[model samples]
Target chain A: MTKTFDIVFALWPRCAQLDFLGAYEVFAHLPGANLRLASEHGGDLTGALGLPLRDVEKLSDIERCDLLFVGGTADMSAATTPGMLQQLRRLGEDARYVTSICTGSLILGQAGLLRGRRSATHWAFLDQLAQYGAIPDPARTVRDGKFWSGGGVTACVDFALELMADIEDPTYAQMIQLYIEYNPAPPFGSGHPSTAPAEVVEALRARFGEKLGKIGGVVPTTALT
Target chain B: MTKTFDIVFALWPRCAQLDFLGAYEVFAHLPGANLRLASEHGGDLTGALGLPLRDVEKLSDIERCDLLFVGGTADMSAATTPGMLQQLRRLGEDARYVTSICTGSLILGQAGLLRGRRSATHWAFLDQLAQYGAIPDPARTVRDGKFWSGGGVTACVDFALELMADIEDPTYAQMIQLYIEYNPAPPFGSGHPSTAPAEVVEALRARFGEKLGKIGGVVPTTALT
Candidate 1:
């Protein structure tokens, strides 16, 4: 019985929250959760928000774990790096549970893990999964038994909790919820594209303005509502 | 009036999680959500679990923010840096929301922000809040009137969602909950001192084994329970 668990994630210069911290929380629970942020060389990689990360463990050293997360990437057009996709397939096969969030789902798909499977990704990037023959789940987190796919970045937490329930005890998840206070409150009436005011939606659009027209489908729906 | 926010946090070699990302999600939702991860120095600060963070904004730039999350310290007796308390006091005067999570609530108390106020922290350290004349709440997220105190690290996300509801749209939190697929599934049934196996708890004690006895009250649950 191993007390420690190592959850691995890919490092990109522009990975989103779902790619990193989103799933990081769930992995944080293992007895001595050894989180490994792996890159080609393992040093410093700038995150999407300009936060530079350092002291990453080289990917090769990670041998096995109870969980492995193939974090999504924003760049789909860019060619997959040499051996990266191959490495993901290897990790996915070894870990007890394999999952992905947002565009990372695409990364897993690219690795041939989701072929003929049902999976989820960030709404903006779901189309990429089509080439992999995965049944796209627009929902927050989708689980096809052992294969888990997270919808958006934040969806990782919810999926993580569900994973917690499966791996640990249901009560453990509830206890964490009690400890962390899972109660939610929303200020605006809108969280999805449909509910947001035209201006608020546009405001969000303007923020991601550069990436529009490339993806398929509408915005996300409020989970609780 | 400006949606710009300054998120002040203590950053060093190894900071806690709930302290960093929990509030980030909420603060990032403000209109512009222009976040500044204020640290003692503007460089990499490794967090628990070997996750390293970098490019932190220096503490000097905090002008105003919707919320200021004071993270907990691994070395509290040696932890209270001098000028930071002063800066916190200065920021406390004008910030729209003054919040803390896990041990961060203690930092807020040391900054004189938690006096006569109720706050929250990891259950393992909740009793410590009483040392600074603040009431501790067992709930995942605790609010003393206007002050928002979060229990443990994971609770920070819940607290952030609550705060987000106040400032942004209530639905956005729901959307975030749904988007992230917050449904949790912990592999083990333990994340807290009470529920974790006796050996696990003892192991943790051995790990933080050197926690000085000065905060004896914080360690023993007799007073808080």
Candidate 2:
């Protein structure tokens, strides 16, 4: 219990809020955890909000992490980079527990770790799994062996809770859940695809279509209009 | 409509998530609003659960933003530098909206902006307010003319939603509440000090005591504790 749990997470530009912090909330607050935000560069990174990121650690040390988490960023192009893809592929060999939030599963997919594996991703990017010939699940959390994942931005909290269960005792996870007030009463019950409004669903479809199409090797949308 | 609302949030090492992203979610996703995260160093700042942050812009061009937000960061030592405080005060003059998450109010307090102003912050840090002579309000969100502030992590979200009523159409704010699924249901039924279990309340006090004691110039804990 005295030793810190070594964790490494990928940091990029334009990631959604819940994607990063939902999980961060559970992990960083764990009693004896030593968390590090590993980036390509040292120092702070900006979030999609106009804010300063002062917690960036070096990416060169990723191999040392016991649990490695990959972030699903807003900028899809960053995930498509050969360098990033290769690094992710290499990460598979080193990571004990590999997980993702939102479209981060796509980065895992692009890394070739998802081939023939079952996983889940952000509702917006779930279809991207098919491009890698992997089975996609819509569950808030999907755990297929060592590959743990969440479905959308907010789902990360649940995923991390489950991860905490897997990493530690279920009792501890349950205790933390209570301590953090994990019981959520979502006002609208619209976090899922089924509950969202038709217009909202359509907007999601219109927005997600091209991102999914790109992995099938189709040319992505050049303009959103 | 002609103005640009590029809100840059600063992500510092060991920064709290709710303070940084709580307000960002309300403003960024408001319908018809164009929000961008200006990554100070150009990558995601990892938080509580090892989630990654992807930013849309960089801090090198801080002038482009209409609002700038900084979250409560653990390493206040680094931000206490004279130039840093001066830079923030300067941003307060240029930016239309300048805010903070959680203890982020302390940064503003340090910048000399909260002098004799009625503001809101996480209850744990209420004592810290006296350092800057900011009158702490127990409300979730307090509005003193242009300075919109919120108490603690989750309160930032509520405060942001309330502020959006002014900056965005009220209907749009409601729509955003619908979109982001803003209805919160805390299972414990205790987020405020008045209703929380005594142990839980004490735990909060113990954990945040250093923040209360250490961040002296911005907050003097003895008076409030």
Candidate 3:
């Protein structure tokens, strides 16, 4: 009999749609995968880019899940709410694997889950993880025990594929890769800070650095390292 | 002044979310992009994998757009409706570029927009494009005049980046690419039939071939070559 895996995605207002959507597409294709999207309040919410997401399940209603996933959000205040963090801490304890994409690791950290664990986040916010006792790793995808994390938005796709291999098998994951035609032919070589032009990197740093400060301010006094 | 490009995505029930979401993430960052999502009827609709999409604009209400995009769908029936085709034809006529990801080319073909055009679609459906007078191009992204098409689902990201380079400039597109951190590192190299294991390819072909037949059944008599 095929074993059904209940995978829950914890989302919030202004969450980066692609951060979770990329992984959602991958896990949705997995045989016996039961994917659910949830939020603190549930129902409708607007993505960071104003995309409307509807029919989200409430976090309080879900009892437990095989995997608990969270994606990045532009607004840190909504993600760091007391109720949201409480749910994450509760769900993360029971989930077979606790995972995240981009700055989502920061949320996991805020939930008091990433302390002393090596995790990954967006290239721009890698250093911020240490504030929550996370040993930030620069790899696009990092796996330390059951806490699996992906870097940036697009890396969620890669992270999910790798997680599938761990949860199921490598062959199954490779098949999903072919199905999605994920042979990425990036038009340019400027995806990372290391590869992007110095001027472009500097410009984005100035923009994202301010957002980083906002994220830092939201971290609770008790959660800080 | 940054010239605002009014881009419209033509969505339908069962449309693959990732097919357009990948491109949407890239285009949403474009300096002057005005993106909108539309369906035959304005309201909420379920995506191919049961993801809820809300506040979709009505197709008939949109007079014209700078670019028209359609993504692949699991159920092609919703895509070939007379009203849907009519709107696509009307929008494609005035749009600066008519674009699609994955099997969306098949929908464009039914709308009579792909007649005698070189295009691309999902690898599994490439040959089927010939029935609609489209010359199937194996390349991941194809552009013939103002009609741009991407191969399979994930190719939409590459297609959008290339289109950005055309609409704005390479540097601008590269900047957007960096913002998304689109450095794709596929955990495996089985994205295409040529690279995937023969057994895996055969399994998917058998599955997708049944879907291809359903697509063929829906092609209008006048549209077929």
Q: What is the lDDT of residue A103 in candidate 1?
A: 73
TM-score of each: 0.74, 0.67, 0.94
- lDDT (0-100) at residue B218 of candidate 2? 43
Please give the range of 10 consecutive residues that has the lowest summed lDDT in model 1 chain A.
A216-225
Please tell me which model should have the higher TM-score, number 2 or number 3: 3
Model 2, position A103, has a per-residue lDDT of: 74
lDDT (Cα, tens digit) per residue for candidate 3, span B120-151 = 99877787888888899999999999999999
Error of 3 at A60 (Å): 0.5
lDDT of 1 by residue, A138-171 (tens): 7767898688977766666677777777777565
What's the TM for chain B in candidate 2?
Answer: 0.81
Worst 10 residues of 1 chain B by lDDT: B216-225
Best by DockQ: 3
DockQ of 2: 0.14
- RMSD of each candidate relative to the true structure: 6.5, 6.6, 2.6
Instruction: Sort the candidates on TM-score, descending order.
Output: 3, 1, 2
DockQ of structure 1 = 0.25
**lDDT of the candidates, in the order given:** 0.64, 0.62, 0.86
Candidate 2, residues B104-214: lDDT per residue as tens digits? 787778878888888777665667777787888766667776677776665566667676767765544554554443444332434555666566555555554464444
TM-score of 1: 0.74
